[model samples]
Target: MESIFHEKQEGSLCAQHCLNNLLQGEYFTPVDLSSIAHQLDEEERMRMAEGGMGSEEYRTFLQVISNALSVWGLELILFNSREYQSLMINPINEKAFICNYKEHWFTIRKLGQQWFNLNSLLTGPELISDTYLALFLAQLQQEGYSIFVIRGNLPECDAEQILGIMKVQQQQRPKLIGEDEAQSSGQGSVLEAGPGVVEGVVDEDEEELRKALALSRQGMEVEDEEADLRRAIQLSMQGKALLGKQP
Candidate 1:
């Protein structure tokens, strides 16, 4: 319920600050900025030094945090825009969000029925309306911006139970197909045409943009997969360290 801010360490430590806030006073041990920063790969470290994180770097950072939290019986579920909207509609307990608005990241936590935006740059938590959230999301969708939802603090369970739960969730959720894939499969368009266009009309230029964006997103996903591999190695090293073995 408490918020964490970067204070003087704005750009580089936003994700770490957010994680620290989420885990502090909880059953799990809180992680510091230095510990989080230490896990970054060489490229990410360079990105941090220059200020701000790109999409892939941010995804990598989340994976690192997820791996760390898993060691302590917590879950971190990353959701796309559609999944995020579904989550908002059917709110879950003990979950938090790391939202990207125009490439700037911030946190949103749900306490009871109210959603609070715990932006580090802000002095205090700001109340967020469901309508506002929906509209904001719609805008992001229109702009083709990436949205990520991170749900944490799930009930501690064994790997099998976790996998089963995830499988069931995936089956129940709607499949979000990429624009390029949808187009290639003759699905027409991804986003609904704007006011000027006819209800079902798809613009040629818009379609091309969507295709380009989809390709770009695909490239980022590859980078994210590599990041996952790196984080897995990092987590393995951390585990060995805890066991008093050389990593």
Candidate 2:
């Protein structure tokens, strides 16, 4: 006898089986659930909600998306946290995007709420408080683009790991090629003495000081212009005292 599953519906039976296995230790694969109906049907609702699913984290997630998602006629398939950000399907394009929480409006999509909630759990509900998702959402919303949410079928990630991804994703765009080339050209000269280093010789002020001190030597043998040299040293020192070290 042919099973009722084949004749009656395409996805419902497989989804039920997948959901059952998911509640057990068996992992849910998209391939396994592909032919199944959306598992968010009301019968799977749990009464023994224990941890974060019912906690403030979930509440904050709700508060954020409450304006954009609805609680009606939708089921959330709870999974462990993963590395990716979660998303709600766009109503127009059917693509997924990071969601925005407003006060009281909801979308026409069934999976949108669950997707937001799942992403909230994975990325931390506080992702709503961040500017990156907000800005991205604003851009998408303005552009009429849709975004898909990544449903986590994976394990929990640490804060450091999650934040590192966020930081890289949030970095500013790099310099343009023209600007980069210009900057390189500006700095392309050979490394030379800067303000502090004397070019090709010892510092003039230090040289003058050495000459003045040397001219004061009692046993000097130079006869030509030793007095002139002494006077020149005095003049140089006086100039340095007035003008300070020059390049």
Candidate 3:
């Protein structure tokens, strides 16, 4: 994974610069901060210039980038601070990451098992140890600072296979139902459902299966929305030259 540092730009465009570096490659084109800024409403752009982007604006920007990248079969996943463990454990090949530290944003890239910090505000890329990164995340959590993990170029996997893996993992762990749901199901004392059979087992199994199906349908709906957004962006880019030459 090649680490692309952010380019120096005016105003509070750190997030934009970090995203541009993250998406620069064959599968995804580099993002232009100026073009994005121009597209924003006057008030939103002014907010960015005055005090940096808020959470909602940053999320919308990420969605735009994600929509563009989806054309080439790439996906971006944003994990909140609560999901730091999942972000650290998952290894997506040749991906870029943007993380927040001390209210400032920075970029990071992973090559094999090693991580490199490519903070444009700094002098150069610095090799970061996994242990150190974990400790830093813990400290951030303790201080109640907002931390985010933006991962690009997720690996493609078969939907069925992914679901199978999820099912297996869920089965291995104990399931916690809400107090009301448990009472209604007449399984109030049950902390977890064992592999063995129990009373009203068929009904319980049917309910769980229905919930899984609903979740699967929701996932398909999201995929459809992403595909539609990708097509719209592709059409918009057709024959419309980008401002300035490609970086």
Which has the greatest TM-score?
A: 1
TM-score, structure 2 vs. true? 0.19
Candidate 2, residues 63-144, lDDT tens digits: the string is: 3232212222223322112422254423332212333211111111112111111111111111121223334344434433
Off by over 4 Å in 2: 1-28, 38-129, 146-155, 158-247
Backbone clash count, each prediction separately: 0, 12, 0
Leading candidate by lDDT: 1
List per-prediction Cα lDDT, in the order shown.
0.41, 0.27, 0.40
Q: Which stretches of candidate 1 lie over 4 Å from their true place?
A: 1-11, 24-33, 36-59, 81-94, 101-104, 140-145, 152-247
Candidate 1 C-alpha lDDT tens digits along 86-181:
766543343566554222345565444444555443434445444445444444434433444554453332322333333211112111123334
Tens digit per residue, CA lDDT, model 3, 1-247:
1233334322355555555445433232233444543466546633433343355655555555555545546565544434555546643433556554322444565533555555444333445455445444444434333444544344332322333343211112111212234335553332333231223444544444323222222222345445334322221221021101111
List the candidates ranked by TM-score, beginning with the highest: 1, 3, 2
How big is the positional error of residue 171 in model 2, measured in Å on the Cα after superposition? 5.8
Score residue 229 of candidate 3 by CA lDDT: 40
lDDT at 95, model 2? 19
After superposition, which runs of candidate 3 have C-alpha atoms over 4 Å from their true positions?
Answer: 1-11, 24-38, 46-58, 68-72, 81-96, 100-104, 140-247
